[model samples]
Target: MKKFQITFKGQVYELDVEEIGSATPAPAATKTVAASTPAPTPVKSAAPKAAAPKAAPTPAGAQTVLAPMPGKIFKVNVQTGDSIKRGDVICVLEAMKMENEIMATQDGKVSEVRVKVGQLVSTGDVLVVTA
Candidate 1:
């Protein structure tokens, strides 16, 4: 059994909880002996976790630009066949009452404008495709 102390609304409470694997009930004699003895404190251990690999910033020859966050496309600045350079604003997205500029990560000729103005897009949704 585990003992816990909780404070709520200025009131304090003491609670006892049993572990899941310990399903059997204690005998009357054992219960009495346990009530007379104090319980031991628990210790916690921390372990480091490995970081996950990230996707490539720019896709191959024909690349698609994805939305970085969930939002509605406020405006699309480019069309098919448009020439663009790195870091050029491709669209304006509105999310959480803020406007965000979606920029091109690499220089390419836009082959597809995947999303339209006023369209709702989610994180990682394709916004534009470049060739």
Candidate 2:
């Protein structure tokens, strides 16, 4: 039997594990217990604020850039009236602890910046509009 200690979310726990091999017969039953410890106090988070207002409609014939995945907007690289070309990085998205560059799909003038830094977005959510 091997003993191990692990810490998770500021809580420490002890564990016992038994290893068996194909050449060795397995025990019919086994039991293990962890050292008891007082539970940690629960944290209270503030109530969520209301959703932000929706962005204005995209201009006719404009190309809208959409979020590729659910993440927080790490940075916005372009603003309204900025000229951009195909493959230009429009913004940076932080998802799963990785930074992803959101690029423009078509060339045009940025008509609107629909999201801001630190704002959470979902897949298919509009990020920018270009015309």
Candidate 3:
């Protein structure tokens, strides 16, 4: 058996360890002592801010493109009145440390761009409208 002292996060602890032979299993044990310093005061967090407003509903006969996942708009490749084809890269989404290309699902003229660069978006959030 051996005794050792350990300091962590400004707190001190004492430990006791016993050695066992290869054929014998060691028993688990733990001991804690009251800290000498007073406990820290709890911090109060500020209330969460309201989320950004979503874009207005799509115009009649217009097809809408939505975000595939929650992420920041890294770049916008197309704008309102721009013509697009199926599979065209519409914007770049930065999610999980990766830049994903948001593509057009069908060919059409962009009637509205609902998002801008650096805007945070969530899955199924309207991003663009086409007609």
Candidate 4:
């Protein structure tokens, strides 16, 4: 059984979950067989751990909003040198058939525009540089 805390719709709640199963009992006939078999070696997966949130900027003003995921730049709403408010729509990236609004992470002028409409972008491809 595991207890977890979850928050949604402005309300937080505690949830208790129980596994539906009975514990296995040791059988006398299988006791020797279990001891004869070597313990299975644990598999160390080559895959790395769950990545940290990439949305947060590495450092302030050196911010460059990336694709977040592999996607195409659908539309660019802001241009170079435009003074933008925080959270302004800088571009639209279409990933998995959804148009995602790429927002300005800080209040600054768009110093460089690296993408345009209908351009396919990969992860970490600089879209716009703000300073």
Candidate 5:
């Protein structure tokens, strides 16, 4: 057995290690235990909470625009009753640090905006509706 002192991320640790001669390779899993003082409890605050924006309901038979991937809504370009054409960019979505434009598929008036700015959406989640 050998004693060694190691410092990681400004924390010091003392470890005792024993070497065993073996023909078979050792098992793959390993664990580490750290001995330290417990972290302090977080302070509670009395600040008021802001209300999260809600997603609007999708209209029946309206052309539904869905998100292509999981991301946050970066910007919304269309509003209810806004005229849009096919291939027109209606919103911007940020996913994996990339900005993606959500476009209109058919010429129509925007019937509903199903998502809001800064909202997180998953793949195939409804984003907009046109009629």
Candidate 6:
């Protein structure tokens, strides 16, 4: 199971998500594991420490936007150095079979494009850096 901590209305909640194999079993290995570990066990780990902002100048010269979740790149709507406005569809990401529109959080020029079409990206991996 995966746990998510969400803050809402000044309150925090912990959600437990039970992950079943893909809606359909693609192979027989799924049956074997199910038979061995009758019940799914959840793993727990220590909380991650928060990162402090850098006081020195960033060599990149802009804020970087990353993939909010891991997924395959479906399409790109802008190119390097292209100016984008708030809420523009920057790219399409296919995660968990859903198409997520990655939007620009701020108005800026695209400084970098880090992934190619059809490429897979991980959560928090830099997708674009804007100047």
Global CA lDDT computed for model 3 = 0.87
lDDT of 6 by residue, 51-116 (tens): 765334434568877899999999999899899998998899999999999999999999778777
Q: Which ranges of candidate 4 are over 4 A from the true structure?
A: 1-61
Q: Which lDDT tens digits does candidate 3 get at residues 1-131?
A: 56776665555567977776757665555656578867767444445556867668778999998999999999999988999999999999999999999999999999999889999999999989999
* Runs off by more than 4 Å, candidate 1: 1-60
Per-residue lDDT of 73-115 in model 2, one digit per residue for the tens?
9999998999999999999999999999999998899988999
Taking the tens digit of each residue's C-alpha lDDT, what string does model 4 give over 33-124? 47679987744334444665453333464667777888988989988789988889999999999999999888988877888898888887
Higher-lDDT candidate of 4 and 5: 5
**Full-model lDDT, candidate 1:** 0.83
Count the clashes in each prediction.
Answer: 0, 0, 0, 0, 0, 0
Q: For model 1, state the Cα shift of residue 43 in Å.
A: 57
Residue 23 in candidate 4, Cα distance off native in Å: 57
Spell out the clash pairs found in candidate 6.
none
> Which has the greatest TM-score?
3
Q: Is candidate 4 or candidate 5 better by TM-score?
A: 5
Candidate 4: clashing pairs of residues: none
* Stretch of 10 with least lDDT, candidate 4: 24-33
lDDT on C-alpha atoms for all candidate structures: 0.83, 0.87, 0.87, 0.77, 0.85, 0.80
Q: What TM-score, computed on C-alpha atoms, does each candidate reach?
A: 0.54, 0.59, 0.60, 0.52, 0.56, 0.54
Kindly report which residue stretches of model 6 are placed more than 4 angstroms away from their true locations once superposed: 1-60
- Give lDDT: candidate 3, residue 49: 58
Off by over 4 Å in 2: 1-54
lDDT of 1 at 56: 39
Q: Write the per-residue lDDT of candidate 1 for residues 26-107, one digit (tens) a residue.
A: 4333344477687865543334445655543555668898999999999999999999999999999999999999999999
User: With candidate 5 superimposed using the best TM-score fit, by how many Å does residue 93's alpha carbon deviate from the native?
Assistant: 0.5
